[model samples]
Target: MNRPVRTGTDPDEARARILEVAEQHFRRIGYHKTPVADIASELGMSPANVYRFFPSRDAINESICGRVLNEVAEIALAIACTNAPAVEKLDQLLTALHQHNKMTLVKEKHMHDLIAAATQENWSIIKAHTERTVTIFEAIIRAGIEAGEFEVEDAAEAARAVRSAFMQFFHPVLIEHCVQHSEDIEADLRDQIRFILKALRKRGSLEHHRQDQDSQPIHG
Candidate 1:
């Protein structure tokens, strides 16, 4: 039932074809069930040739995972570079991240096991992705501070805090758990963002500050 492998492309295209077929098998059956031979067979090539491009099955997985995470990074970077205020940008970034995780882990689940393995194995790709995310957060926080929109003295620390605070909404494992448990994720996410904005905003700028002052009784 399998088609014969055709050879005419250069090395670059050949490697790319291997990755494409491997991803197809990964999505169809799963990472573990799909072997290098299956991917090679799908491409009408030998498993040895697949290794010519990738050293091992795990290497192929890491490459694919990196590609997926890189997509999110690119999206976040574009949002961070926008003219929107830091508050609005942060909200969009977090919302986008949650949506991405929901689509990947909850809806499609094509790469869930690979992500889990990356987590347990402490893959370099995962570490790089986390660092890149933190760096993007830092950039947005720095912009807010420079624009006098946030009161934080240390942008890097604030960025780290934001990432840690929103881990529940952004982290893949937590996202999966919350989805499976039917948690009110959106409500909680909104509340958390509100809290983050309140903490970041320069005091006295919020309308409620003046309202509270007007409501207070005169003191002797």
Candidate 2:
């Protein structure tokens, strides 16, 4: 006789299994359509049992979304940990992030939809991811400043500005809009990066220009 399957009594294992099944369902049939019952059924458990692990479907979505964001964060962390100069690291990091996101949209349409929805809803996971990414940017900026590549007074503020300026390339909704409109996203991203680099370098020049003006005798 075949042995009966068990859902297992370990809470952590149960939660992990739930997330794995839910992610599979989300990728296959889309998260919006994959009810909690379906996930429980797939695990040979009752919906109420699934609820014991995750309070609600949204909570499950948040966990899955967090997992996806963690992948992107890992990419950023890898680029940051490289020995390249700060300027080059920042450029490569931004390009890699953009390419990864665009690839996801093209190759993982269902997963992309889930992320887009999470972004639109302003999920806490999204905010946490953004903060983590900004922290990475801030570290890069600080390194660049130390290396005399960037001349910003506040690395944190500059990092936030960089994130804001690059939102078009990073934000899922904006990226999708660009694709739908057939915009030259690659060209635009390059232009934007160049513009940001220029801004970082120009701050020092502007400061010197003001000092030069201050040193000159004022005409009475």
Candidate 3:
């Protein structure tokens, strides 16, 4: 049964309501199966009224996907702003990103389908998400440079490199592939993070990392 129209709302609130209901229907029934008319009916409004807020169903899908992708972006931004060391912050950021993708794609295949469709459709969401991620990576790299932890002539370029190097670990489709292939994902992910940190560190910092590794006795 549809809920009563949320009374006394402005345009922004109405749009939000449509999105909220639309997301529910999409999550429950699949994005392609859900119609704007169904979303409108849920909100006790007509499809025409819904179109007044969003131009079309594709617009709504894009908005929903963007909102979902922004969760990772928000987490990365928060980590970038933290008082942690750049290396540690980067590690945490990467781990969080991987886990978030796994949780969404591997564990929650429904959401994965939504994201995959958005990506295949070439929505602006992917470009916007990539820009946000690169910005966060650049912030961390700049911090490492300031802290004398990293040696890089250009933070933006280094950030791009880092993103490229870790793409396999963070990309949703790639992560799904690893799962399906039964790859040694944990060991590979650790190796990737180790390599990224080693590449980003100054000569002295790299030496220190090597020494730290050597100092730890091997465990059988």
Per-prediction TM-score to the true structure, in the order listed: 0.87, 0.87, 0.89
Give me the runs in candidate 1 sitting further than 4 Å from their true place. Answer: 1-9, 206-220
- Sorting all predicted structures by TM-score, with the top scorer first, yields 3, 2, 1
Candidate 3: where is the Cα deviation over 4 Å? 4-9, 207-220
Candidate scoring better on lDDT of 2 and 3: 2
How much does each candidate deviate from the true structure in C-alpha RMSD? 7.1, 9.6, 3.4
In candidate 3 the C-alpha lDDT for residue 44 amounts to 85
TM-score of candidate 1 to 2 decimals:
0.87
Each prediction's total of clashing residue pairs, residues at least 3 apart in sequence or on different chains, is: 0, 0, 0
Candidate 3, position 198, lDDT: 89
Residue pair clashes in candidate 3:
none
lDDT of 1 at 189: 68
Q: Model 3 over residues 161-213: C-alpha lDDT tens digits?
A: 99999987777677788767755776677678789988999876676665654
Residues 7-97 of candidate 1 have per-residue lDDT tens digits of 5557777777777777777887888888888888878778887887788888899988887788889889989989998867886788788
The residue-level lDDT of candidate 1 at 52 comes to 79
Model 2 agreement with the true structure over 97-144: per-residue lDDT tens digits:
888888889889888888999999999999999999999999999999
Alpha-carbon deviation at 64 in model 2, angstroms = 0.7
